[model samples]
Target: MSSTRVGRGGRAAMVAAALVVAAGCSDGTPTGSGTSVPTSAPTAGGSVPGGAGAVKLTVDSTVATGIEVPWGLAFLPDSTALVAERDSGKIKRVSGGQVSEVGTVDGVESSSEGGLLGLAVDPGYPGKPYIYAYYSGGDDNRIARITYRDGKLSEQQVILEGIPAAAIHNGGRLRFGPDGFLYAGTGDGSDRPTSQDDNSLGGKILRITTDGKAAPGNPDGRVWISKGHRNVQGLAFDGDQLYAAEFGQNTWDELNAITPGTNYGWPAAEGISQLDGMTDPIAQWRTADASPSGIAFAKGHVFMASLRGERLWAIPVAGGKRTGEPQAFFTNQYGRLRTVEAAPDGSLWLTTSNTDGRGDSRDGDDRILHVTLGS
Candidate 1:
């Protein structure tokens, strides 16, 4: 596969072909290095000839620093960002470049990749005044609704529990869909059978009401909207179509176009399997190039944060399908990115994960970067 880079004066510069095979590995350690790509500034918004030519990524500023493995990022109505730290179980508030610990989530147990993993502010916001969190509890991974008012978080109520938990691959990423229901991604928790078992919550994309009941009209009235997943970490919607970023076992990492009642072949297959009764990914990369985590849709593209790959990927989409080849940015410049969220101001907030005991920690081991998009 070939990679494209935006060069001087917004020209599409073709880079060398991607190495055919990357060493097999999970998201633990990087197996290969990335080619350093130069960035060019171009005006954002209007569509260019090719989708990839429509936008460019550039870091605008550093939002916060010295933060530990920040995983989930959600914006309040006031544009304040609540960052969930994976190891500390603390929810920090970032406003105008100041980061402050608002409160610690109770009963959170930090393990390998567990802890406070993902957060979603109530879509109703001030009216609902609740923040939803998915974390590793005593014996299982659970979701809790906490009250956030006047700059403090209080009154945590566990709304859902009992998704299998493990030191690694405890999938945790939360977001409210366009329908205003909470959608959660869970891993197989090292149990491969669970990925194909609808009776189990592990390895599935779950849709439920804010109160934790299965959302109405789900397949068989169960909370599961889809099954057969390995470790899903990124969920975003382009209009009504949902896309997911998943960590593969060894060979391929996936970017899936999600649909209700669809089965994504996980234990059976990694990337593109044309087998019957399974859906293939819209895009895939070698695990070494993309241990992708959180993704956000902005500037006519889906921006994905890669951990082992140590880069940000911009995949152009039209009508929820890939319109062109994916492009990489900031390769090896920032180490092990974990999350990316689109801000209200049309910019993006990206988080690093070097301090997660995975990558080499830098001066500010883990930090949030503000990014602006251009043509």
Candidate 2:
């Protein structure tokens, strides 16, 4: 699957619409001994020629039997997916026609935004087999590494620690970059100002070695990659370009393409507009089109987890820009959509956030959905 971000005419308009909507409120670790070698800038797949209004994905099916308050999810090397249960602090393996909890992790602070939030598999996994997780800790946020061996939890170890925590805004998302390092997005623990402080780790996109130590090439000596974020819950690299999903505070939520040492305007700025040297969002929406969570790049589209909006938005992204309107689908049909992962089998793995305290829950509540790309 190839992927890239865009910012042209139609894409520009879609982003502008998102901002207009937001005027209201606001909102990787690597693998084993060696990290996954960085690949060339990714080529977004599901290619559909032309500019904005190019293409979109359809929801073929939704899996509901075996999930609860699903937060973050990652597709395994074997094409399966590991999904997190936000309230239960459990990791479940979903594949074939079955879903089962691999096991419940310990030391997870599962209250409100705490609990298991984001996940990534060791890039070398299946061959090396290790899983990385981001969860809310008693007093702060923490990263842990464990192995999903034969559907059970094995080798538990906390690799990173010391992030701010509150009942909400504990950003918990992790991804293994092509560079073979682990990248993490953290929240300000309800303390919005911390995102702008260099010494602080909250509300920033952090980069580190596969082993959880700060990467040698870090922009700052610490793990802080870029600061000034209010609450960022989604992180993805479409090639060398790293894009993030940020929650706006009473203003606009944003989708930004990150550059090394780039200051993404947060608490300081809501939606768009160049503020001094701070970079603005390539696209954004009123905390409504967005409230975005786990993000995935696949089939030439950027799939975002819209929490407050109760929708799975398909933004036809190309060359780093949005092509058309934020296609709002699954609006409350399945409650909140929290995570999306591109699957090896040419499909998608998504998590429902229905049971996440603020959403509407059903008998099945949260579950992982496996489906074909939409037309």
Candidate 3:
């Protein structure tokens, strides 16, 4: 287990690299970011060969099975992982290759796309020992803080609420950023206008303290870090650069580089646009190919999970920008893929969403798959 440190100066380099990649000029080559793709023996699943300077990857193993709609995953300091089930509201622990329900989140209204969606452990866990979650409550979406001790979850408290919720567009993905603040992805609650409204909490990425208040240095001292999103379901940080996986309507699905106070045109712009004062997505996919969900960054690339597409996409990140075309893995082999999370062991943990009333569920219906990057 090696330690990976992405410093601020490195972030500037990544941004510069991303700008070059965005300009559509730089060749798809890694810039020695201290992380290298592994060259290992072929595993059970076939390997996907990398393009020039791209990281090669393969499916490692299926770690846990029989999970019903596992939506969120967060690794503990001890390398144990917690998985959240959307429809059941159960928080399951994965340790020693076994999955066991530790607790269920109360008052979660599981409707369509809404449910217990995202989970994050306190950065100072054991000392803090709190598990944070984003879920759909009775009337809206909310964040909760729960205590974890002796392998049990207790002392649940709703720390934040008031974001609009919808059966289909309840954005729910929680993560603790490099700056130690909690950030949340939210949807427009099916009202496109809310994405453009600065006062609305929906359709935006929110930066807040662990206690759920506005984070320090937030624009205008508010929870909004950026605005104008349709339904942002995934948020990841590479060094200091933030990237969001957004669900676009009808036309496109987007991967956007997040900048604070920036407006990503939502209803006004679905995919590519030259609209003034609005930020455009660096990468866009047709709706059928990428109904993107949870995303994770590893090995100089961003891995996005797709529900409708039924695959995992690896988008190369060089210098800080996305380069070349994305490669798809496990296309329709594991039903609907919902989440891709980086693990402590440098592998990726992926959850299948077959039981989410959409996919072709098998005997296990849903399961967690482990992926290893290889050369």
For candidate 1, lDDT tens digit of each residue in 1-375?
121111111101100100111123445753533322222212222232246457766787899998988999999999989999998899999999889999999989987678999999999989999999999874678888999999899988888887866666678999999999999999876666778977778789999888887999899998789999988999998878888999887767889999899999988988888879999988888777788899998766888899988888888886768887777777788899999999999899999999998889999768999888767
TM-score of each: 0.89, 0.83, 0.86
> Which residue runs does candidate 1 get wrong by more than 4 Å?
1-25, 30-53
* lDDT on C-alpha atoms for all candidate structures: 0.81, 0.69, 0.79
Displacement of the residue 274 alpha carbon in candidate 3, Å: 1.4
Clashes of 1: 2
Q: After superposition, how far is residue 123 of candidate 3 from its true place, in Å?
A: 0.5
lDDT for 8 (candidate 1): 17
Q: Show where candidate 3 strays beyond 4 Å.
A: 1-52
User: Can you write out model 2's per-residue Cα lDDT over 157-231, one digit (the tens) per residue?
Assistant: 887777776666778889888898889998766665677877677778889875677788887577868888877
Candidate 3 residue lDDT tens string, 64-172 = 9999889989999999999999999999999988998899998898876788999999999999999999998756788889999999999888878877776666789
* Candidate 2 Cα outliers beyond 4 Å, as residue runs: 1-53
